[model samples]
Target: MYIPAHFAAGPDVIRDLLTRPSAANLVTMTSQGLLATFLPLIYDPSAGEHGALQGHLARTNSQWSEPAIGESLVIVQGADAYISPSWYASKAEHGRVVPTWNYSTAHVYGKLAVHEDPAWLGNHVRQLTNLNEADSERPWSVDDAPERYVSGQLRAIVGIELVITRIEAKAKLSQNRPDKDIDGVVAGLDAQGHSEIAADVARARLGS
Candidate 1:
């Protein structure tokens, strides 16, 4: 993560990246080489000094079973978009503008803890489901399914927790641009149906 001074992420941005309804790429280095799994994770604030990310992998997924040689990594990302030079106000004034990208991401590093316990898996699934379904009108629950079926399903997966040691995060949301150029970017992104990253840029501007 090459974080420029102006593109650094703050505490709130990092918190949102962890807590939002999103997935992460969990990477580990093993004798079999580097293995990665895309997984949905929930931040558990009480787990360690810096908290932990909790998720699960299928029992058949070798990434969970492989012995990690050292610290594991989780790549969490937020809204990202392509920024057109036409959106920059300075483009007209100097014609020196080039297209760029706007994004927010975090590289989370921690120790991996694996759990095969049924009780742990059950609770984790419930938490993850609720978190993702929070915005849904008819959110489903673990109890909605048959008890035996739920237990059977849990048996097929293994829970994983990343006990956080450190994190390197970046948020490059046009923060380096001038105010008028940033304003143009917001309007352009909105017209292009990228309101999510537009909102991120707007918010980052305010914070800056």
Candidate 2:
């Protein structure tokens, strides 16, 4: 995460982005080599102020085949859009603009803890389900399902808990550009039908 000063996000911003992103790419290293797994993470704020993350991967997946409690990297990516040179005023004035990516990303470095307790793992899975579907109008809960079936299903997965030590977040939304240039970028993105990137640019500008 090579975040320039202009693109650095505050702690709250970082936490919000991570929570909203939900899914993350968790990377771990073992004696064999590096392993990466795409997982949906559940944010737990019950640990006082700073929170922790909980998730799981398939037991058959090599990513969780071995437990490495040392250092791990979890990458959470937000909506990203390509920025064309045509979006910049400088492209017309001096032809100095180049294509760039405007996006938000967060990298969390932490120690990994693997849970083996069946009770804990069951609760962990249920909690994750609740968190992920909390916003839906008619949400399904773990208790709604058959206990024996749910327990058996949970047995096929490996539970993970990350004791996060550091978080680096960056929103590369053209903060380095001047106000007019940024406005031009936003307008161009809006015109080109990239409303997602335009919204991100607007949020970045407001935060700045």
| Reference-based TM-score of each model | 0.98, 0.88
The global C-alpha lDDT for each of the candidates, from Candidate 1 onward, is 0.95, 0.81
Off by over 4 Å in 2: 48-50, 191-193
Q: Please, what are the lDDT tens digits per residue for candidate 2 over residues 1-208?
A: 6878988987756877767737889999887688898889887767424567789888888777675647888888877888877767777789887888888888888888887789988888887888778899998999998989988988898888877888889888988887778888889888888887788888788884
User: In model 1, which runs have C-alpha deviations exceeding 4 angstroms?
Assistant: none
Q: Best by TM-score, which number?
A: 1
Q: Candidate 2 deviates by what RMSD?
A: 2.2
CA RMSD of each candidate after superposition: 0.8, 2.2
Clashing pairs in 2: none
lDDT of 1 by residue, 1-208 (tens): 7999999999999999998988999999999999999989999989999999999999999999899988999999999999999988899999999999999999999999999999999999999999988989999988999999999999999999999999999999999999999999999999999999999999999994
